[model samples]
Target: MEKIATREAYGRALAALGEEQPALVVLDADLSKSTKTAIFQRKFPERFFNCGVAEQNMMGVAAGLAASGKIPFCSTFAVFATGRAFDQIRQSIAYPRLNVKIAASHAGITVGEDGASHQALEDLALMRALPGMTVLVPADAVETEKAVRAALEVDGPVYLRLGRAPVPVLHGPDFIFRLGEAVCLREGKDATIIATGIMVSQALEAAQMLADEGLDVRVLDMHTIKPLDVAAVVRAALETGAIVTAEEHSIIGGLGSAVAEALGEECPVPMKRVGIKDVFGESGRPEELLEKYGLTPYHLAEAVKEVLARKQAACR
Candidate 1:
């Protein structure tokens, strides 16, 4: 299995899109190297702008470019992109529904040594709250490229979350990326594991571990956080009877919250959320942070068993 960072894929995608879309421009808040937007800058210098550590100003500039009929992509660390420039994003772009792409990198605890200040655990929640803002969290390099192209097609604001660490390539050449649609990775009848971002791979691993124990588990890659495929979530709840949602974010308002909300309104069922437990991330290796925060495949498998037990109890 090959591994590649989502940010690496994003940079390659931007460079590829630049050739076809002349109106596409990129803006970075003095972190092009980390965000990987430097790839685009190298290919098309005239179209790239370095905003010099001003995330708010960069967003305003992106909004202006969009207003001028240019498709602007703002790149920066996820914490600064969503937290430091939140007001500008909300007022300048999302409020007026500007056609801008906020492609933030180094999102979630996977940021590793950057610590809690740099890690963006709530970016998804913030982006999902905005009206008409399409939020995407691609599972791997392959999906990241597909997501970048899909975000271009959307007319309104888009928030594309990316990670710093390399993850397994889950999708193949035939995989089609669709906005606001959940991809069913594996089929099972006992229960379902719904995941987004890097957690998608972990969910698949957990499902396989459960299978060895004779417990059939389905796996869903919910790449889109907003306009969340409620139909698929409802269908999973109705068929599987139990579900476990996993993500490298806070459980309050990420993939877990979204799935729980949909299940509550449509088809209620036994479920467990595996994510950051209302806390901040600490400085450590990516794998270490994941284990410490209970975001690993073992934790997801345990959550599945817990939810399965609850589902059986409900039937009794």
Candidate 2:
């Protein structure tokens, strides 16, 4: 299987979109090469703006460009993009509901070797809290490209959370992506594993491992977190009887919270959330961090059984 980082895919997709959409523009906070926005900058030099490390100024510029009917995609590290310039995003772009796309790279604990200061474990929470902000976390390169195109078509603010590490391709070119919809990767009745971002692949692996042990677990790729697929979440709860939510982000306000909120209101069930447990990340290899943070396939498989046990005990 081929492997590519979501950030690389974002850059390629933005460059492709630039060819189709004349008003499309790219902005980087002096890290275009790392963020992969250099791909677009090289192609559309006139439309690209290097904001020189000022995320606040870059966001304001993006908002201004959006107001002028130009679709601006602001790129930077997720931590800086969400935390450093949050006020600007809320006031300039989100408050006004401008057509600005914030494509943040190196999100989550996968920003290995960069430590907690660089890793953005809480970006989703911050972005989802904003009014009318659309949040997307793609699983792989294919989905990242599809999401980039979808975000470009939307009218208001869109936050795309991208990873720095390369991941295996999970979908083919024919895979269609729709905003606020969850994709069921595998179907089963014992339990359901709902995951987002890089954890989607791990969830799939966990499902396969459980299958070997005669446990049938459903898998769902919940790419969009804000306007969550409530119907799918409800269906998973109603049909599977148990749920395990996973993500590369913190469990506090990410995919787990969104799923729990939906299930709590609509269809209550036994649930287990697999994610960073309200702690900071450390400098290490991406794979090592995943294991240490309990975001691995083994952990997911165990969570599936743990929730299933609870569900069974409840039924008895």
Candidate 3:
């Protein structure tokens, strides 16, 4: 399969949506080309706004546009989109439930050589904490396109986190996407691995490898971080006897925390989480960081094996 970068998918999706929806507007902080909003700027020059290196001001501008009934999508590196302008997003978008979409690029360790300063590893936690905010992290290029189209229909504030690295297409054109809904890619009873963002693909790869060792692993794409698919998570916990939650964000407040919150109240199970540890990242390539932080398919496979072993021991 030909791998395409998630940023490219955002560009094509923005261009398609810009041509179709006149009310849609895009803004960037002098990084339109890097964030992949240049495509939308090219096709819909009047609707696109380049705020020029001012992330905070760009966020404020988006809020103003949203107040005026225009659906604004603010694009920038995820760090600046949420870190620098979090207060604006909180007061302007979430407080009023404004119809604005923050399409953040270069999320997670996928920013590669740009180092930890540009990577947005904490975006999921930040966006999920905002009241009335909808957080969506697409797994790959194909899913990124679907996520962009879906963000428009959501009634309130939505944060669409995207990445820069080229990844394999996990779904075909027929995949249906919806906000707050999780997709079950593979079904199993031995153990269920719930993952979001780029880790979804890694979970799937781990499941395939584990199946060869006689462990039937279930894989779920838990894309919506906020308002997570609790029912699906609970059902998996009840059926699988164990779970492993994974993501590209910090383990404390991302998919792991959400799943633990649901399962702890409902059906508790022997479980573990795979994600970035509670520490700041350093400069490295995406693949190197993933391996260093134990975000690889090998690590996921090993985690599943360990969790299954623990569950069996408890049963005995």
Candidate 4:
């Protein structure tokens, strides 16, 4: 179980993409080191821009570069790039459907010690609301690299959400990635676990634990947020008759809500959300906050059992 930081994978992917595409440019908001864009800067200084602490300016510059036929990747903290520059991204990039990639790092509550202000739990809801913006949340480091390359190939404005925590690489380097698609990690019939970002790894561990308790749990890697895998969600609902969605984002409008919305329309069943419950993060280690916020494997396993009980009791 090798754990790699998603930021590092994004960095390597960007460098490789830049090498292949001359039109690709990287821009950092004085966060080359934090966002891991330094690798690209070291490799192609001419194609990288270190815009000083000005996330808004960096976004505008990226839009301009894209308008001139250059694919620009604007790297910054998720909170600043998505929430702080909402107007710029909405009007300049997404409204006009520019070929700009918003490479947002340190997303979700994984960014510990920096406290609530730096944590970006609401980034998904914000970016998903923008019209014509494709939102992606990779499960692990290897997936992040694949998503970075795939997003560059997309034609419209895209939001690539990466994290700071070191998550286990469940997938191989040869793994294929497609935008707006979800993958079924584990198959079962008792219940289903739909998760995204770092939660996908935990959900897999939880599923194994649930199996030990004689409860079957299926797991889905919902890497894409905007064009959510509605077909997969519907299928899971039809097969299992229940769903438990887990994520590192807010329970209101992130993966949990997305899955619930899809299920509500077609196949409604017992549902529960395992994520941050409308709360702010505090200064602490990543693992501690995850435990406190009920994102651990045991918590998810327990949630699966609870939802299964609900479904069973509903029939009576």
Better candidate number, 1 or 4, judged by lDDT: 1
lDDT of 1 by residue, 213-237 (tens): 9999999999999989999999999
RMSD (Å) of each candidate, 1 decimal: 0.6, 0.6, 1.0, 0.8
Model 2 per-residue lDDT tens digits across residues 1-316: 7999999999999999999999999999999999999999999999999999899999999999999999999999999999999999999999999999999999998899989899999999999999999999999999999999999999999999999999989999999999999999999999999999899999999999999999999999999997899999999999999999999988999999999999999999999989999999999999999999999999999999999899999989
Worst 10 residues of 2 by lDDT: 107-116
Candidate 3, residue 108: lDDT:
89
What tens-digit string does per-residue lDDT give for candidate 4 at 1-316? 9998899899999988887999999999999998999999999999999988888888899999999999999999999998889899998999999999999999888899999999999899888888888999999888998899889889999999999989999998688887777988899999999999999999999999989888888999999988998999999888998899999989988889888888889889999999999998888899999999999999999898888889999989
Q: Order the numbered candidates by lDDT, best leading.
A: 2, 1, 4, 3
Return the TM-score for each candidate structure: 0.99, 0.99, 0.98, 0.98
What candidate 1 gets wrong by more than 4 Å, as runs, is none
Off by over 4 Å in 3: none
* Pairs with backbone N, CA or C atoms under 3 Å apart (clashes), candidate 4: none
Worst-scoring 10-residue span by lDDT in model 3: 112-121
